[model samples]
Structures are given as C-alpha cells and as structure tokens.
Target: MPFVLYLLGLAVFAQGMSEFMLSGLIPDIARDLQVSVPAAGALTSAFAVGMVVGAPLMALLSRRWSRRTALLFFLTVFLLVHVAGALTTSYPLLLVTRVVAALANAGFLAVALSTAAALAPPGAKGRAASVLVGGITLACVAGVPGGALLGQLWGWRSAFWAVALLSVPALFAILARVPAGAGDASGTGVRAELRALRAPRAVLTLLLGALVNGATFCAFTYLAPLVTEVAGLGEGWVPGVLALFGAGAFLGSAAGGRLADRGPVGPLLAAGAVLSAGWVLFAVAAPHPVALPVLAFVQGVLSFAVGSALISRVLYEATGAPNLAGASATAAFNVGAALGPWLGGIAIAASLGYRSPPAVSAVLSALALVVAVAAARVGRPGAVVVEPTR
Candidate 1:
C-alpha cells in the first residue's frame, strides 16, 4: 500500500472518531442536555441522516473535481463544525452541527474510498478498501475509548474539542500527501452514472449493504446501555469493553480483507451466518459478566467482517460507474446507521429491555444472510458475477 492510503486512512480515522464517539457520550449528553436517553441516542441517527443526504449531493457537486480536492473541502467543513458543536449550548444547535459535520464526513468518506480504490495497484482493491475502512476500526480501538475517557473526565463537549484539534493535523496530511487529481470520474457522466446505479442488480447490492450495516448498528447503538445496565458493569468499564469490541473489529477487517480480495460473496455468506448466531448468543448471555466481553468481541468481528465484504460487493456491482459506487455504498451504510438506532430506540422506549436490541439485530442479520444467499443464487448459471478488480 502507498503512503497516501495511510494518509487517507488517517483522514478517515479523524472523521470517524467524531461519528463513533457518540455511542460513549450519549449518557452524558442525555444527562447534560436534560433529555431522555432515547432522545440523546437520536443524535447518532441525525449524523447518519446527514450522511444519507450528503453523500449523493457531494457526489453530484464534486463530479467535476478530483477526490483530493473534494476531500480537503469536506474536511474543512468538518473541522469548523466540530468547533461549533463544542461551543453550542443548546441541544438543537448541537444537533445542527452534528448534521453538518456528517454532511462533510459523507463527502470525505465517499471520495476517500473512491480515491483509495483508484490508488491501489491492480488486484489490491480489497486491501486498499480495508486500509481505508481500517480507519474506522482503528478509531474504535483508540479514538472512541479515548474520547469516552476524555468526556468522562472533562465533559462531553470536551470530546468535540478534542476531535476538532485532531482534524487540523489530518487536514494538513491530506493537503501534503493525497495526490492531486486522484479519483476523478473514469468515463461516466452524471446521467450515465445515475443510469448505472439505477440498474436492478446494483440497487439490490446497495440494499444488501444497507441491511448488513443496519443490523450491526441496531445492537451497537445501544451497546453502552447494554453494558452498564444489563451486564451491571461500572461506568468505568464501558470504555474497556468498547476497546475490546474495537480490537475484535480490527481483526475482522484484516481477515475480511484477505477473504474479500479473493471475492466478497463467500465471506459475506459466512459472516452473515455467524453474525446471526452471534447476536442470538449475545442477547442470551450479555447479562452474565463472564460472557459479556467474549460476546461483544464476537459480535464486533462478525459485524465488521460483513461490512468489508459489503463494500467490495457494492464496488463489484457498480463496475459501469465505478466513481459513483463508493458514494452509493456510503449512502447505503448511513441509511442503515440512521434506521438501526431509530428502530432500536423505539424498542427501548417500549420497555423491551436492553436485550431487545440484540434480538432485533438477530432478525436483521438473518435478513442480510437471506439477501447474501439470494445474491449468490442470482449469480448462478449464465448470470454475470462482477468480482472486484483484482
């Protein structure tokens, strides 16, 4: 992998830390803002909603520009908004900042993924994607837990300030390292890209990506409560457990990359099946202290392994409009991000207990498995299977 790939990964790490750090801050945000926990959880969905809206809009706006240019612009907006979020006194203002930050993040991630793919040597797309996605996984391992501890010590707003400070270096790195004119549109125009995305096969592939991500977030968004409430752990233990989850996710991304390099379908099927079973075990055994860490790690591994495969699948399916494929995948992932937490919040509000989410996640994972199987069937006997560029 080129040094630029790591720079892009660093950019992703900075952006993603702000996004995923919210899971740890929710309890504090709820307490400080005088809102219900469910209300605080909605902040996660708001960020996702912004991503859902921002990705395609950024894609359209940046169609004529190089990805490095788009990325710099997006990171600029992200940096400014994190400062705004840190300073805001009102929840509504904070929410607005979160949304805007997500818009910027969406643009950054969409372009970054495309840029990474373009930068890779032939047959290395999966590894390149992993290096990029590894940013988020690494954010989990370091950034989120660090943010959680920072918030715990100084306050939730301090975490936002920390993220803002981190972004400055990332922005400089992007300016210095990411090559100019990387990831410009290959051959497709806006109309042609839209047409290719509208194909039934492409749409289905994107839906599967959304489903897979949604299933993961359904339980993940509520994991904090599950840890402190169900498992009866101290508040101090939350970050440690989250770190364990991140460690598992990191391993999963590496293994999934190797599998996806060969092809994502097999890994997708295998991960999906394991995820379904894992969620069931998670829901059943999460309350037991002895089982909590083990279950959390297993779930994280399966969830992120599927994520890598899904991204590869989306890229493979969008071969006709490769530039738009990363944006489409970003949109799909955020759509699930918004949906899962919103649905999980509903379940929590209804008094279904913290365990309810894993049950919901189990159903969603099963659906993803069904989609994966269907995709395999669809590719059989005379059907074209578009494997990622190797």
Candidate 2:
C-alpha cells in the first residue's frame, strides 16, 4: 500500500473529528455565545446540511483538477474555517464557519475516496476503502473524546484551534506524498456521471449504503441516553461504552475490507441480516446492564462491517463515473445521517423509550438488506466493468 493512502486517512481523521466533536461542545458554545442550547446545536445541523449538499457539488467543480490540488484546496479551506470559527465571537459567524468547514470536509472526503481506490492494487480496492473508513472509526475512538477534554480544560474554542492545527500535518503530507496528476478526471463530464448514477445496480447500491447508514445512526445518535436511562449506567460509563463501540467499529472495518475483496454482495447480505437481528436483540435487552453494553459493541461491529463494504460496493457499482462515485457515496451516507436521527427523534417524541431507536434501526437495516438483495440480482448478469482511476 502507498503511504499516501494513510495520509488521506489522516486527513479524514481531522474532518471526522470536526464532524462529531460538536456534540460535546454545544453546551459550552451556547453559554459563551449567549444563545439557547438548541440554537447552538443548530451548528451541528448546519454542518450536516453542508456535507449533504457539498460533496457532489465540490466533486463536480473539481472533477478536472488533480486529486492533489483538490485535496490541498479543501484542507486549506477547512483549516482556515476552524481558525475563523475559533476566533469569532458572533454566533451567526460561528455557524457560517461550521457550514464552510463541513463543505471543505465533504469535498476532501469525496476526493480522498477515489484517490485511495485509484492508488490501491487491483483486487485490493476494498482494503483501500477500509483504510479511509478506519480513520473515521479511529476518530470516534480518540478524537471526539480528546476534543471534549480540550473543551473541558481550555474551552470549546481551543478544540476548534486543535482541529485547525491537526489539519496542518495532513496538508503537508498531501503536498509531499500525493502524486501531482493523480485523480485527474478522464474528461467524463457531469452528464456522464449523472447517467452512471441512473443505472439500476448503481442506484440500488447507493440506496443500500444509505439505508445501512441510516440504521446505524438511528441507534448511535441515541446511545448515550440508552446507556444512562435504560441500562442504568451513570454518566461516567457513557464514554467507556462509546469507546467500546468505536473499538468494535475499527475491527469491523478491517474485517469487512477483507470480505469485500472477494465479493461485496454475500458479506453484505449476511452482515445485514445479523445486524438487523442484533438491533432487535439490543432493544429487547436494553434494560440488562450486561446485555446492553455487549449488544452495543456487537451492533457496532455489524453496522460498520456493512458500512465499510457498502463504501467499496458503491465505487464498484459506479465505476463508469470514477470521479463522481465517491461524492455520490458521501452524499448517500450523509443523507442517511440526517434522516436516521430525525426518525429516531420521532420515536422518542412519541414517548417511546430509548430502546425504540434500536427498534427503528432494525427496520432500517432490514430495508437495507432488501436493497442489497436487489442490487446483487441486478449486478449478477451485466455488471459494469470499468477500472477505478484518478
């Protein structure tokens, strides 16, 4: 494997940390800005919105540019936004900065996925995708908590500063490691990319990715409450439980990468079924202290295993549009990220318990399984046979 792949992972780590760290910093931000907590929380939503919209847009705009240029531009934008966000006292300005940072993050992620796949050896693209996804799982394990600690010790602004500083190394790495002309598009315009997306197998694959991600986030977004309220654990236990889940995700990504190397369909079908069952089991055993944590870890493993494979599968299905495939996958996952929490929140608003989120997740996972089956059938006979390239 090329060292540049790992550098892309490092860049992803910084972006993923920025995406998730706000959950722990919202209260502090609200107090400092003299805004309501919910208003401060909107910053997170703003970022999500940017990510959902920016991935494809940025990818299209930069499709002709070299991967190195696109990455450098995005990272520089991300770093500057964090610096601006940290210095801004006005809440609206901070919100704007968050949106801008997320846009940059989305662009970088979209480009990085293609770049990784292009850099990997034939039949090893799955492992390359896993390397990138591993950065996100590792961020969940270390970066988010570390950001919270920084917020606790120095203030939320310091966390922003830290994210800015973190991107510096990745910026330098991209300059030194990534080949100058790598990931330059082959002149397949936006029309060609859109046509590729219209393919049945590609559509189904993207839907599967979205459904699996939705299911995962539906449960994950509410996990802290589930642990405290249903499992009867204290606040202190939350971090440990979350860390356990992150550890599971990291392991799952590695395993899923290997599984995907042979074929994505079978592993997705098997994992999706087990993941749905696991969610149901989790909901049923939510009140059991021992069972709850164990189930959370298991669910994490299954969910991310499906997720990592889906990332590889999407690129494979959309091979006709190499430059846009990564962005499409990013959009699909972010769409799920937005929708899953809303669905889970609806369940809670109706007075359903914290366990209800996992139940909701189960339904989403089952839907994903159905989509995966459909994708497999569609891909069996006349699959596209384009190689990934920069």
Candidate 3:
C-alpha cells in the first residue's frame, strides 16, 4: 500500500511498453532498416529469449545487492538501451539492443516484484504484488496504443525515444521515493538461493506459475485470427475487442489483489476454474460475433487474476531467497509464453481450425487447476494458508 509501490509500477509500465510496442513497429522497422519482415520479427523473439535467460542470471548475480539498487541498475541499463535503439541505424545493432533491453527488463521485474513484497505490510504481499504487476496490465491498455500512435505520427524510432524519455520520471521517483535498504539481501548469497530452488514445494509453485501463464497465452497469442477468421468480425473491430480485454485486465488485477491478500489458494483455484471454463466456452463461441468480445474480456480477467497469489506463494515457499523465487517465476512465465504459442500453432497447423487454440487453452487451464490443487496441498494438511511472515 506504500506509494513507492506505485513508483515501481511506473518503471514496469515503461518495460511493458517496450516489450509490446515492437509489434506495432514491425512494418516501420522493416521499411526503415531495409530488412525482411520476418527478420524484423526476430527482434521480438530475441527479447523474449533474453528474458528467459536473464531472469535467473540477474537474480544470481545480484543476490547480494539490495533490491532498490538492483532495480536502479537494471532500469538505467534499460533506458540506455532504448536510447541506443532510437539512435542506431544498423539492423544488427538494433537487434542487440533489444536483447540487452530485455535482460535489463527481466532483472528489473524480478527485483521489483520481490521488493514490492518486502515493502508491503506483513499480510498484504499479494495486494502489493498486484499493484506492481498492474502496471504491466495498464501498459497493455494505455502504453501500447500510445506507442503505436506515436510511431504512426512520427516514426518507429519515436516510440523508442518516448520509452527512453518515460524512464526518466521513473528513475527520479525510484531514487527519491524508495527508501534505502528496503529490500536488502546482503547475506543471502547464491548458495542460499540454490538451496531454496531445491525445495520441492518451491519448484512446484514455480511450475504452477508457468502452467498458469501457458494456459492464458495458448489462446491469446492467436486472438487476432480467432476474432477475424473464426468470429467473422471485421478488422476494424479487432482493436475494440482487444481494448475490452485490456480494460478487463485492469479491473481484474485490482480484484485479484484484494482476493490474494486474503489468501493465495482460493484465488489460484478460482482463477484456474474460471479460466478453464472460459476457454472451453470460447472454443464453442468462436463463431458468434457477440460472444467473442465477452469471452475475450473474461479470458483476460481470469488469466491475470492469479498473478499476485502466484508470486506471493513462491516468495513464501522460498523464504531464504525471495529474489531467486521471483526470478524463477519470471522465467517460468516466459517459458509458458513461448510454449503456449508453439502448442497452439501446432494445433492450427494440423487443420484443427482457429478455434483449436482455445480448446488447447482449456486443456492447459484444466491442467493448471490440477497443479494449483496440488500446490495448495504442499505445506499444510487441510488447506493452503499464507502466514503474514514466511
């Protein structure tokens, strides 16, 4: 509930914008760089790959640093990368920038989540985590669109310039607002973190987090095709439907925070259940014009609702090393991000139809629910209970 949480959220918003804005800039980048569209698309893939590798590596490297310092270090690197991206003319240089930016982004996010939990009131880590992650959802709603518009009005480089500029306010806020020594982990070395990673319950929770993300992205990555080809909606309607999903995400994050603060298990189980049913319903309703938007919104809501609880659960189980736990969750989530789309693409390639993605998503969601149930049974005999202090 501290104001510093909001400040950290601002930093996250900048990173989120950088991650997604590339989608809207692909054509512009290709034209400007005189590269193939697929080559330009590789930039996005590079960022994602960097995240999966950077999360754990940064946590390991920064195990002895305070969270605030880690955040500042990464954010500064991120800002510089964007500046280089904005100025660079060489296609290879741009690609390198993207990868380095993603590394900084991954480090910042892992530290930020753990820092948010560390700074919150004893019982409100879930709520605090939500507020931190909510910035990413808000970026989906606001930052991406704004970046796209800016790129259209100016150029693709304009978006990078804007993102770099945005980091300034976030830097100032972090320096001025976040107290020193707030997320100190001086004595907690890589050995302690490695030991934490060896715990069975901690590993399960990390995988559960990954599965939860896999379930969401399975359908989401192919949403455009689902809306236009399957639902029979015009291309113009795509933005509106996506906007509805973003709005739902914003609201869902706030609601999830409250629910997660109470306990992690209920929110995890409920979110999984609703998401499973929603994806199944989406598969059936893919052809209905009215139903597509409704289902998209519901999917967005349920997909993100488990985020706070998942982070909180991991932090709890890895009491010896919160940063590593957060980094593991980040890596797991990105793994799911990469895995879900591949699985959905396989289904589509097999002539399973556009509706196949949601069907795949449903199965994944059901599997995630099973994982959540098992995760809930990890620490306690009766039900999952998150004590105030791990």
Highest lDDT, which number? Answer: 1
lDDT of 2 at 233: 87
Model 3 lDDT per residue over 1-390, tens place: 888889999999999788766545665788899995446656765776777799998877777776678888999999999999999999999989988998899898888877876777877766787886688778767776566567667888999998999999999888888777877654667787789877776776667667666766667656656767888986456556656666677777777666555654565577678888988999999899999999888887877776445645676677787667678766776666656666776787788987997899888878877766765566431113455434
The lDDT of each candidate is 0.82, 0.79, 0.75
Q: In candidate 2, which residue pairs clash?
A: 183-390
Over 4 Å off, model 3: 22-45, 84-95, 148-158, 232-235, 264-267, 345-354, 374-385, 388-390
Ranking the candidates on lDDT from highest down gives 1, 2, 3
Q: After superposition, how far is residue 258 of candidate 1 from its true place, in Å?
A: 2.7
Model 1 pairs in collision: 123-390
lDDT tens digits by residue: candidate 2, 241-334: 7677777888888886766666434445777899999999989998998998788788878888877777666777777888888898788777
What would the TM-scores of all predictions be? Answer: 0.95, 0.88, 0.84
lDDT score at residue 255, model 2, on the 0-100 scale: 81
Instruction: Name the runs in model 1 displaced over 4 angstroms.
Output: 264-267, 378-390
